[model samples]
Target: MFEVNRVTARSSSLDAAHWQRRLDVLAENHGVAGAVLGILHGDDMMSAAFGVTNMRTGAPVQTDTVFQIGSITKVYSATAALRLVADGVLDLDKPISTWLPTLRLADDAAHRVTLRHLLTHTSGIAGDVFTDTGRGDDCLERYVDGLASVPQLLPPGTGFSYCNSGFSLVGRVIEQVTGKVWDRAMHDLLFAPLGLDTTMTLPEEALLHSAAMGHEHQADGTLQPAARWGLPRSNGPAGGIVCTARDVLAFSRFHLNDGRVPDGNTLLPRALVRDMRSTQIELPFYDGDNNALGLAWFRQTWDGQSLIGHDGYTVGQNAFLRLLPSHQLAVVLLANGGPAPDLYRALYSEIFAELAGVAMPSPLHPPQGSSGFDTGHHVGTYLGYNHEHEVLDDDGVPSLRWAATGSLVDVMPTTEGEYEAIAAGGDLLLYREPGQRRWRPATFVQLPDGRSGLYIGLRAYIRAS
Candidate 1:
């Protein structure tokens, strides 16, 4: 319920204390157990940590308190691969089979998967449900080898499906090619050079002394401890990282400064860093927003400017890292709680709106584009196991009617190629590729049959050219 003037430009200068107070207010409002906020601008960086790291002990959350970073580890893996590429030790386009010969997929298309596909989450591999399948040394490799037996959900590079297995494969590739473990390779290549001392792939035994305990919300809205087990060290590339808010900001500063450390060390080449921030695949299904997957980061625009970053979620924790390149501003939020995608979105929107002097809406809408095909043409009684899609009318335009678990909702188009679907007190935008296709809402999948399936996650509809 806060407002900022829309007409005035935001000053490059921000009041750190004021921002910290606002963040504290927001944390309380959201019933967050512990939170950390960090911002970096030019040579000046400010960070604040609040709430309790351990509710039982009433331990205060310190600025350096370590928290599980989840998938932000992908950024570390991607950077390591890019470093190898920069050093001529690896090829981004080479068949991953060159490094990991045992790699196979359910379909022959598996041979076509490359390092690029894995980095961009376009490897056609279905994501894995977390399981404690193996011991420390071979956990990631075993999981990756199992990928050959798992059915591919889509053709490589055809669409975006966030696949952690792909990243785990990348980790294996790193180990295979480098003759070192994934964590050690990452440390030698990226973390050590960047002086991110607090960023680590495995929690030290000493971590128990200072790490934050994750929390979950109970039915009565009370917070309770959420237990989480340590992931196998071999799976470090996917989500084994633990770090403090300040360390995250320092790592992000390299990207914000175009690959140079704050002290002027060129850890990553500027050209390669730019490529990492560039969009490799367009994720239209995630929301109407134009999201492009970089090497590991997801790049998007907010309020007319580009931001490069990613968010992470594991069993009992959530984290967000966003960098506004033009403003030389970056924000990192870490919370010890079950993953809350809505909270991340809301906070990001609220902060951006405040910075841009705009009125924050109930749910932020993705940028507008041309409306794609008329929804009516595709509207039908189509069904999937436990999921259904229906086309409905909205102000003379076609919209999606969805029914899941006996709950129904309508999706209306805000712009061409973009539609917003309302569900469970939240809205999500659907972005369409800009073109006419023979298959309307076609789901793309790689089936065991000789032929691939293009109707997996899509709805089929015929449209007039």
Candidate 2:
């Protein structure tokens, strides 16, 4: 309903003006309130902003307007741990319990979880759920201490299951080492040294800037600003940083530059930065997603051109960062709402093709002439951090019923939602989202611990035993 100003900074290879036009058109077409894009092409940085900061206020978005960067904060936490590793204050391969002796989880093998396991999401900690500890300096400590209620998804050092609690625990470890909370440590170590003036963690800090709140799409085809700003402060270490696209791009540049600070000091060792992009483990194919992860960085290929980056989402906002390390090119996209993953595909596919000569792979869709799929292996209840997934029989076809539990009810599509799906083949299920013709992919995959798991919406749900 609101279409307005677009601002841009130019570069040699990136046509900010042209891309601003494209962003404006695409944003409106996709019904997003606004989007900001920043690019770092071989040190030639450029940024463009399109649409409004808030649909309710009608204020236009600017290149510097801060939006929640979501789980990308995980990378920042990993960097913090690596910095400690660089200083001999922490050991990457050593058990985290060495640092946080009070650490507890429901799983028996939790005591063996190393910093490396947490960094790579192999800690097997059930992490989707987050708690709101009091807004105090000890919030992370309380959160980590309460992790005893969380069950294990797999086994430590086993396989990949995207874990938010793992990163938050990493924040707790950072606190123990530096005697500073996660936010202060990140600001001192990464933000200050990297010159990310707009990057911040707390809502109070974001209030000083032109912060963009998210807008949710309604079932009646309307956009409404999200009811909440972000997740609780306790979860801040995992998914709660707020920053401009430029800051996101700048952070990417630091890693791409091998951790060099602007004033010649190295914020992180070059080997550690490279290790951040190296393959720690391979993730199951998530269709158009990076299938490999390294210390919170996701590695994926486009036309055999490897890229290292991460994407994140919260409430109603989505943020994406992709760095073509070999090409000295990185891009960041921050959007308030809508089918943002689709927008990422549409815009980034072209950007990489033009700027990096890499072709983005097409997203997967349901194959035509598809036949009935066996639902035997995938039926049953799978437990997640925030909800339980029920694989049901919808008139002979497999269907998923989502039921939000614990603290996720506020963010779920509804208290309960169901999607009828047809398996494309072994484990790949295709289902059309409500009111959309496009079929989306979900999978019933095996966990490293050999348990059947459901992979959907970038979160893992292990079969409830």
State which candidate has the highest lDDT: 2
User: 121 in model 1: Cα distance from truth in Å?
Assistant: 1.0
- Give model 1 RMSD, 1 decimal: 9.1
* Candidate 2 least-lDDT 10 residues: 1-10
Off by over 4 Å in 1: 1-14, 205-209, 219-221, 230-234, 286-290, 338-465
Best by TM-score: 2
**lDDT computed for candidate 1:** 0.64
Tens digits of lDDT, candidate 2, 17-55:
777777777777776778898888985888888788788
Please, what is the whole-model Cα lDDT of each candidate in the order they appear?
0.64, 0.82
> 122-201 in candidate 1: lDDT tens per residue?
77776543434455667777777766666665677665666766788888888887888777888888888888888877
